[model samples]
Target: MTALLNELHAHYNGAKLDPSSITRHLEDNLLSPESVLKIVVASDSGGEVVGLLAFTFLNSLVDPAPEKRLQCMIKELFVKESFRSAGTGRDLMNWVIAHAKTAGCARMDWHVKATNEAGIRFYRSFGAAPVADRASFRLMLR
Candidate 1:
């Protein structure tokens, strides 16, 4: 799992991930029934993990409708380079989307870097569109 995270970080040109932090997060989520985090992994016949998708279930008071109150945000979706185009990623995505719908989520959302043309293409093929009205922002606590 840590190796897969490292590959995801590489794809983002981001900082190295700390295995201990990852372990802590998994442990916390696993032990908490109220945890919103859900991570799904796909393994090969030989039991090697080839793809992963992580997402969070969210609720917003802004959506007055009960069915629209719940939403899902995909934090990451990655397939091993060797597994690309083998349907692993699509299978993972389909599984997550179905799971979200079953969980009463109104919609599923994710972000793709502007420079990641391939990523954009994959998402477009999956029927995702850009939200032109919103811009993403973040602040580092440290």
Candidate 2:
């Protein structure tokens, strides 16, 4: 877990992640371990942290769903710069999807930056379709 956090911190150039926040979160939540999926390293070498994926789980509202009856949010993803095109991200997404399937999830969702053309393309390659009718906004607490 610590290894995964460090990898994402390096990839985002100190954005998207705050190490102290993760530390505090682990202290609070790792005890019971809820539905949230935090950053996790994908490593080849025993101690090497290459990339990570962060996600969350949600119960599906729809009735008569065939799968886990839950949904997943792909919150954050990152591959080491040298490993970007090496299929690490794809593998990570695959793992997430498999996990959702095991958890009886019916759907998965996540957002990407509109300006991230490469990211969009990559996500599309993984069968992520764009929702043209919806809009999203966020409010900063501070």
Candidate 3:
């Protein structure tokens, strides 16, 4: 799990992943239910971890609808390069969709890098579209 996470983080940030930091963060968030949920997909042949999906459920303060207050946001999704075309990503996403629905989430949302054409295509395959009116901004604390 650490290795897979390292690969995913490095691919985007080009930073070395600290196993202890990752483990600690997961433990802290997971200990509090609904903070973050992580799911891993393993290869059937050798039980090697091939993909991972992490998402969080949040309640929008401004959304007045009771049943629609909760929204699921995918924090990260990644599949091993060798497993990209093997439906691993699809399976992980399908599971998250069902899980969110079952939990009464109003919607599921995520962002993909504009330069990641393959990621964009994969999300679009499931009817996901970019929100043209919105732009993503980030601030680095560290």
Candidate maximizing lDDT:
1
lDDT per residue as tens, model 2, 1-142 = 5556655666567655677787776677743366456555588666566777878877766655656567888888887777788999989988988887888778888988888999999999978899889777999999
Candidate 1 lDDT (Cα, 0 to 1): 0.84
lDDT of each: 0.84, 0.76, 0.82
Residue 60 in model 3: shift from native, Å? 1.8
lDDT per residue for candidate 3 within 14-126, as digits (tens), equals 88678888777666764456565655455547877889888888998899798889999998888987788889899999999999899999988888889999889999998
Deviation (Å) of 78 in candidate 2: 1.3
RMSD of 2: 3.4
What lDDT tens digits, residue by residue, belong to model 1 across residues 82-126?
A: 999899999999999899899999988898888889889888987
Model 1 segments beyond 4 Å from truth?
13-35
How well does candidate 2 score on lDDT at residue 106?
A: 80
In angstroms, the error of model 3 at 80 is 1.0
